[model samples]
Target: MSGWVAVAGLGPGADELVTPEVMQALAEATDLIGYFPYVARVADRPGLVRHGSDNRVELERAAHALELAAAGKQVVVASSGDPGVFAMASALFEALEAGPAEWRLLDIRILPGITAMLAAAARAGSPLGHDFCAINLSDNLKPWALIERRLRLAAQADFAMAFYNPRSKARPEGFARALDILRQECGPDRLILFARAVSTPEEELRVVRLGDAGAEMADMRTMVILGSSHSRLIERPGSPILYTPRWTE
Candidate 1:
């Protein structure tokens, strides 16, 4: 509660996902900055000031957070999913880099939390049983060419893939294009795991072949897992969860 700020991931919605360190950080924070919905997740806690912004106001949000931290406030910049994976931590750092030297002296810490891909993989039953990679298909910040290149490489290498930002309103066909390219590299027999709004009330999940993952199945909130050639389906009595190893046994 003394120096700079602690940027932490709240992990999904479950209270169990919040680590004790993050909880302590939150309890000590004088100010919190996050997207509106994620901010609402921790609203019940007392005495914490919050600055909630819309998704489009990322630069503003980052600047505001850094300003408070630079002013010697104990700030917690929260992201619902892991801070490192397509979250505010990078944005906040980028803003600080372009701003003044004030942030240079402030203590900055990053706390890891459950990423959406890990959550989805756990729920889908071993979709990533070998080498895997995660790719964000959103072209807002990154160009389609870069995404396409990664997709081709992941597919060619037969690495399972966890796809974030698979689709948005402006680019509805992005997932479809990616699927086609993946099919070319890994073939149509490969599996695609779709998990939407994981750990939330409206959660939904599915396992389908690559050739069949169309527009109706994906959206902004969806996370897709495309299986590697080594991956296989495991049918059990109840729900399924995916597992990919760091090494083959």
Candidate 2:
């Protein structure tokens, strides 16, 4: 049987949020590969083999998927959020480009799924209903100065911002520094959101002003969204609805 590789997103955490396309791909895959927790999301089946690896090994994981595909095994590389968004799609392409020439000829596909930022936005109403940007706060691959520069520019643009990988054990101070920059550029009155483990049993959402926002509210599993200056809250019986008006002056 001719082999192919499908890099798919399983969405944030809930199985119901996973896309049908990704589900079909997983069902057909002979081999599944990804980070430990993402691979664990898929159940064991009679004909399927699971390969889970540690974090920070994206390129190696991509290469392994390609190797399996070249050997006539239908492989699926799973990612937590949209594969194309801060996930495995870019890594897979990077590996393919630097790999043997024949690897490019293999059939490869990317399947999209709901990203954490969107999931968080939905839970909070529509803070991102207007123009916004998604930024990965981890400096694992980039410089801290670059991240600071981007944060300043985004604040100046008055764009609602969604952040991924806000804080991890290795880079505990980065998110604190990020909060400082935002407070300086956007001021303390700006709204900041911490959406932790959205759609999962551990899900928690917190909305606070920049003045009150703290670094401890976020971790690897959390997604942070900072509202534009025009964003406002609508008081309700339960949690308030946060949204930015679609019109601009």
Candidate 3:
């Protein structure tokens, strides 16, 4: 076919954070498809058709993109943050595998962007400098039990952890439960950083001890970083620097 599909990341909120590659893909796209907010990021122009859908219809959106591409449409799937990192890239591939054989022959590309985890880490002075792992705290797709298990295991393994979707109105209590688990496994003294809306005008950063971290500190827009046993802070004048040492003895 003469058409292609590109799953492009819009990066963490800031227009400057968006990579040139994604911008180019967006410019070349004849049709743009993704969740409403993400698709809205790309300004409308002549010859560019935007297909915005709700957040819950990932599979449907992916299938639509594939169908459009198969019919010789240049499609771009917009995703917030890195498309491959807990975003539309995986959903697109899942659709491809379950789709017709001819869909596999269509050109597909994944464009990377600055993920919220990394953006949050930078805003809080590199809490992820050492070994780290990212876990989505929302249990929309996965079970709460699995999320709890992973949280405990990650703490036990001494990995500086980044959390996405830390809290939401629908599942507000989950983050509180998570904090209780963290306090139990990592103790009250462990470091935690809450970064909200990184690189945006509404950005806010807060660092505190595990005991001091309230569930209200994080909402869906916040990225929470739980420091490993080796993570520490350097206090000088301004907001303290939270960093995990490269060498943990």
Please, what is the whole-model Cα lDDT of each candidate in the order they appear?
0.81, 0.95, 0.94
Worst 10 residues of 3 by lDDT: 117-126
Better of 2 and 3 by lDDT: 2
What value of lDDT does candidate 1 attain over all alpha carbons?
Answer: 0.81
Over the stretch 2-60, how does candidate 1's per-residue lDDT look in tens digits? 56778889986777878888888888998988898888887556777888888867777
- lDDT sort, best first: 2, 3, 1
Across residues 5-96, which tens digit of lDDT does each residue of candidate 2 receive? 99999999999999999999999999999999999999899999999999999999999999999999999999988999999999999999
Quality of model 2 by C-alpha lDDT = 0.95
lDDT of 3 by residue, 1-249 (tens): 789999998999999899999999988999999999999889999999999999789999999999999999999999999999889999999999999999999999999999999998988887999999999888999999999999999988999999999999999899999999999999999999999989889999999999999999998789999998999899989899999889978
The list of candidate 3 runs beyond 4 A from truth reads: none
| Candidate 2 runs further than 4 Å off | none
User: How many angstroms is residue 25 displaced in model 3 relative to the true structure, after the best TM-score fit?
Assistant: 0.4
**Candidate that beats the other on TM-score, 2 or 3, i.e. the better one:** 2
Ranking by TM-score: 2, 3, 1
Question: C-alpha displacement of 69 in model 1, angstroms?
Answer: 1.2
